[model samples]
Target: MKKIMRSLGLMLALLTLTVVVSACGSKPLSQRNVLKTDQQSKTITWGVKADTRLFGLLDTKDGQIKGFEIDLAKAITKQMLGKDAKAKFIQVTSSTRMPMLKNGNIDAIIATMTNTPERRKQVAFSNTYFYAGQSLLVKKGSSIKNVKDLNRQKGTVLGVVGSDSVENVAKVAPNAKVLQLTDYAQAMTALKSGQGQALTTDNGILYGMSVQNPDYVVTGGTFVSEPYGIAVDKAQTPFRQAVNQSLKELRANGQYQKILHKWFHNVKGFDYEEAARE
Candidate 1:
């Protein structure tokens, strides 16, 4: 009988310890000083898109993701953590970026994420770093010229899952069906495969897609404003502030303009001068 009680007590103690450890492991990242941690480690892991062109696309030749956001992240890491500090990149999709940030997998998100009221409730965002607007992409010579045309034809629109573009499309074209894909590459492929009549996303992304496929064109000028911002875990004010400050410095020192021009100067129809002014 004593041996039985001893075994029961041991089991109970082990269970209690498991619970305690699990609770600590699941603690909210907001309670920790992520900036200090990054400073100490001298590395900031950034969540970036690996599929979107001109913003963050995986280069098949070099196996490195390159584009506007990648350059900006490098500049910001240097500005915030000193030139010697390293910036690590992790591929994140619209569906995975936020969870990765909240779970402490990445230090920050420099992907083409828009700042919306709904998203603001989940994670903190830095000041507007890039301005874009929701737009549609369609194959050349297609009858669908704009959002209204989609509604008129009751056509289907492809959107990336977890992005506000899907919600925006619903608002603009109530009659049109929206098919959410995993990422931009999939959406573009679906569009090519006749799965959807139009692909809706930020114009910047659409532009990149169009550049890759001359057969597609971004039409129906922006309907919804999409101001892009860098995202960090909620309540990390010091880290957020550092990001905002770095952006300000980048703009003032002309580094921002240089980066913008480097990627966007040759993008047909994009007004690089106006973007620089912004």
Candidate 2:
């Protein structure tokens, strides 16, 4: 009788363990969403930049984040989810964006992130949504016509922290000094304050800076190509593929052109049509 009771107790414990393991294994992918979103919720939380002007910026009047990247992310989210899908924006900076995505704080990141091999190790990227190039921003009448001109001892370039521009500028202008700031606003302030002779970043971003400050100009058309892509957590192949499909559909339906034109058409030096090319 004693042996039988012990056997029964052991059997009950084993069964309970199996059931608990199965429950954990069977948890739905939707429940594990980074932003705590799912089909039922019909909402996609996006990590966007509040400081970037054309890419993502907070409008002072309405207090809403608006820009080309914001519009693009919304379009993609709608296409992937449904027409009625809603986007909830969360502001993320260059340094915080990746960590936020990793921590499940945002569903997707679309704030001017460039696709690179190193980034791919941490997060999967959607197809190339936009193409830009590294360029230089300098004060008007400054002699820095191109990146080549910055390859001098007295020249210095400012870039934002967590952006590849600082390392990239070093590769192009080996002799020039490089200073990194927390964000574009700070980088620009540093430039205005004479912390750096020129600001180095994508031409599209440089153009946005120029629009705000007429005293500055974007020179050196393109030193390196920067391809932007939407990012999701690594190993999420299904979600990444869905985003890629949406991008292709957007391009085929001419929606891509409409969005691109709406933002880049007024920029002086950028060629919108060329950028639209695959």
Give the winner by TM-score: 1
Error of 2 at 257 (Å): 1.1
Flag regions of model 2 displaced more than 4 Å: 1-37
Model 2 residue pairs with clashes: none
Give the lDDT of residue 82 in candidate 2.
88
lDDT for each residue of candidate 2 in 1-278, tens digit (9 for 90 to 100): 99999999999999999999999865444446433344568778889999987889899999999989998888887887889988889999999999988877787899888899999888889888888889999999998898888995459889999898888888879999888899999999999999989999988888899999999999878988888889898756677777889899988998888998888788887787556655
Candidate 1 C-alpha lDDT tens digits along 133-226: 8899999999999999999999999999889999988988999998999989899999999999999999899999999999999998989988
Estimated TM-score per prediction?
Answer: 0.90, 0.86
Give the CA lDDT, 0 to 100, for residue 227 in model 1. Answer: 85
